[model samples]
Target: MFGNVFKGRKVLVTGHTGFKGSWLSLWLTALGAEVIGYSAYFPSTPCNFKVCGLDKHVTHVEGDIGNLNMLTNVFKKYKPEIVFHLAAQPIVRESYRNPKLTFDTNIGGTVNILECIRSTTSVKAAVIITSDKCYRNMEWVWGYKENDILGGDDPYSASKGCAEIICNSYIKSFFSDRKNLPRIATARAGNVIGGGDWAVDRIVPDSVRAFSEGKQVVIRNPNATRPWQHVLEPLSGYLWLAAHLLNSPRLHGEAFNFGPDHKVDKSVAELLTDFSAYWSGKAKCKLVNKRDNRKESMLLKLSCDKALNLLDWSATLPFEDTIRFTAEWYTSYYRGKKGMFDYSMAQIKDYTNKALETNNAWARGVFND
Candidate 1:
């Protein structure tokens, strides 16, 4: 999808060693873009980028996003034409343990990115990735729109919510009238499940951890339902939105949510069941009876109509395919699929081709005007 859009473009990716970051880095390389990576070390054991050998493909710079001087130096050096900000403390349960770090990384790091952009004056487009948890957890059944109130209960979620505010505030206070500055937009995606995510405290990772260790995973809230989609679903939306904003700033400098449609909705148990069906593992899960108040919303949904109308973006992957592909990835990797690095690169190649075909068809019809 990005092969044509990013050819010869100088793109800087924050969180280049992260799960989504690794995938995006590979995609940009496939598209023939000169990629510069800026972020701290990989955030977890069995690091996603190292496992996938992504460092060899990117200009890896190990640094903190909170350091203004370092980030500004990178901006000045790379002179990036587009930026994707995905660095953050992304886990809710982990947030409960490290609230301060979460806030500092998510919110403060965002400020640093925008500040660097303001000072460097070379960037042309930027996409700040937040989360669906940015929405105030009302525990309602309705889907959140771009204009809905932004807030959160947990540190991770609240930090993302604060990041959203930062995006808007910076846009209004600094970049709104600076036509030469990069156009900025924020993207909110939900619980993204895929391979190479070995982080503790997340459902998919927890499940993998258990199954790989011959132990059953623990179920905290089997009934809690949030918009679940494959990682590529939102990444596609982000890439498309970035490309659109690169061309037309006025129509794209707002917030957008990207996730599977209503047909993809499933309970936690349902997702696990799908995974188990693929692997046929001897894993089990029991509901926690105690009042385990983790601050996760029981129900969170988002409407992508605004994105569809404005950026001509949509979620093209189905839930079953997501689950099957995810399970198959782990299965193949465990069975020694010529290293996890090639496996991840192969998945990226396949998914990017599929998304390119799908989006090109959609663009022909949607952007024909």
Candidate 2:
């Protein structure tokens, strides 16, 4: 997997307690990397980190990314060879409630990580995880490309856009020299959904909560469309991109979009209907027409052509399989299954098998560069 690049490597994952971060951390460990996780705090109570007992598998550090001193200390102590920066204020609705915190963490925290990478000689490659919302959304029919304008109206989206700008500036100002050791790149992924995600305001988590309690799931912006893919899709791109960066410097400071094919783009209501099919209980949604002060994009999409062309990476799961894999995981967890760590690992294995069946470049350990 990934040309055995991560095997026996020292990998550091920031925000390992969050949804996407936890999954990435576990995958790194499975790849035989010595994984270290740094995070300010767990974003949610029943987070995947705790649910899967990730602490037992990796070195866990608790600190705010905004605190440069603490974050720098972790970098010095760990001396990680590869870094995946996933720490950020990831919620859109919460950003409306606390814009300052969002800016501080998303922008300031990203700066701190770049500074650490700049100073750390042990680090050789990094993948900075941003959002598809980082694009200045025109709500148009077409998907956003890598060179699209960076701007956002909402605080969360704006902060992510600002993070991308900061990363670009750092790359140009500091890491521009060909002699620079740490080759850093940015990844923008579509809305990700999978198991063990219990964050507030996300459609999957909200649906899981409502279904577990036998209540009607509240539908907010049901007609809105998004490029939805399983969590493993983007994670594969990040891993493959990082592996290639270790040997290919031309990709440094570049940005890539990892999203599903255009055929997978679906409305929120459609996602709910497909997700409910695999649910064990009677799953239903109540569409509320109440006015929402917080603004969300009506349509969003990403073009993964860059990733496919440059890294030979593309999303493997279709719409139905994505929903089935997500719904099954949550249902099994809610049914009080033991050893969730093993269960999660099983899902990873299943995803890998699918990738191998399709002969995905990453699964075949084929590096395009």
Candidate 3:
């Protein structure tokens, strides 16, 4: 929880209009930080940014991360002390439709962020978010560590892998010994599912859309196993990593993987089943034999030993709670609940409360007074 560390500090978040970014923006505000966001637009209609009224809390700027001039202007205006770079073409299926955009955004956009950080002087810490797919996934049964091979079969995954490399390159080439420059680090996370994510091709959103329409959900790969966790899981890691990097410059240029417990790895169908049980809705999955030419790993997992050992971070939310929290959120929103913003804040409070009460390292002091 490092609420004291962020209080009154200027923090910049790219992709703040998105699901994960919105939640993080709200969290940073609750921590008493002055937050600013720069992204093109909200990718989905019923996204968490609008659901939680994040725009009211953050100075939301509409811009592209690939535009160096635009990003430099934002850096100059905000003069942020810390940065969270989440802007990217995230969807794997969508990347197949437009691989060029994916490569440019993920790889080139990272270069742009590094360029701005290189030129700026107020920044003390920066966390660049990449996917667990950054690993050259061997479809192994065990989990992939941060030191694992960097490779991917799909454009989205490969682009993230390249982004990781680009961050490291920027560090060695420019930021390695710059005393005034910000310390840069990268975070890799597992499949993150949460409320208000209506992106196409994503399992939860696709299922929610179907169930809302009174139709069954269709999944391309029911048996494919993934290390699924709530969005807050990795966000917590990123926040903690950034806080630590501010003090420990040795952590700069390093990477960490934040993922759920190994025992919680479940197939695609298992997750949807849990969602149905939580919502008390008739959720049936219509598994089809058809497959997209784009290849996703059949079995993917991440080992967070490095994070736990180094940053003292862990996944506090269990597998069932992850599903329940997501389902309850969508159910409340669709049922015309009055306290969308309040309920979301309450969930954040509840999660943090549980973590702190249980003495979880990540939530120890994140709650505001």
Candidate 4:
């Protein structure tokens, strides 16, 4: 019930076919928003979008964000008041294989969006999704704040950092006039895991695929640690930020990090253990003891203090709950559960209940009950 912020609003979500995008689209639709989705290539077969039958739920445009003509046409047609950009070459290992693809999609795509925003008049706020790896990680026990240095070890991470830079550049050059230009901000979240993520390199997807396939998950960098959160954690932040942006321009052109509580940080091995537990030990992980050839951060974390202090948002689910929700969704999916769409909506309602019961500010005054 996010303050009825999305009620009757025309919202556009680039990459709406991805795992997190699909979830956000459904949530926004539930809030009475007219959601329009634009995506280039369907990332893979058996994607979350199709699995949930989301194509029937929104006006899905199959096109690339890099194509200014196509993107501008969507803007002109939908006249969306809010936009969320999540399209990217989102894999780090894959980034190493093709840095140019990563750069072109992550950085150039942002440029095209900003260009279209300049030409369009309907967009009032945009929240671009980046990653926690945007920080120049030193592996300290402490978390990285929004002011921390923006750098990355791998191509994927580096591309995100560059994307942040591009956002700042466009905001400074074009959107600096708060009165005339639309509000824009960047969001960085921890390693996101949930159901319907069929990506190759992600731990949750890999574990689920391995367990479902009756194979051992060969986990590389078993000791690497990351701040992990359910996909909802960051999506909630985006929703609130967009709502806030429409109301307050002070947050315009800013960046905020949305991560799990500090206590929730875990290593690869630790999370794999939870997967095995939730799957009745059917999920197995074969740990690789050797160092990874690709450059990667062993420890990555984000400080959510800015979001908590300024936006009054914090993670409502605990680490165990995050894993439980994720595992349960996959289990039910594998079982050929009916009403999977309704089931997904149930998860959102359940999470909202948790937030309301916890007195989360974003939840208290929102939604037309």
On lDDT, the leading prediction is 2
| Best first by lDDT, ranked | 2, 4, 3, 1
lDDT of 1 by residue, 127-232 (tens): 9999998989787777899899989888998899999998899998888764555788999997888887877778888887787777878877888786788787
Query: Which is better, 2 or 4, measured by lDDT?
Result: 2
Evaluate model 4: give its TM-score: 0.97
The whole-model lDDT of each prediction reads 0.80, 0.91, 0.86, 0.87
For model 2, residues 1-369, the per-residue Cα lDDT tens digits are 899999999999999999999999989989999999999898887889999999999999999999999988998998999999999999998999999999999999999999999988999999999999999999889989999899999999999999999999999999997556899999998589999899999999998888888888888888888999999999999999999889789799999999999999998888988898777557878876654645798889888888888888888998988998898889889889989899989999999999998889999998897
TM-score per model over all chains: 0.94, 0.98, 0.96, 0.97
Candidate 4, residues 171-243, lDDT tens digits: the string is 9988898876489999998689988889888888888888988888899889988888898888989998888
Give the C-alpha lDDT of model 2. 0.91
Ranking by TM-score: 2, 4, 3, 1
Model 2 stretches astray by more than 4 angstroms: 289-294
Least well predicted 10-residue stretch by lDDT in candidate 2: 286-295
- Clashing pairs for model 3 are 1-362, 1-366
Candidate 4 has which clashing residue pairs, if any? 1-367, 3-366, 3-367
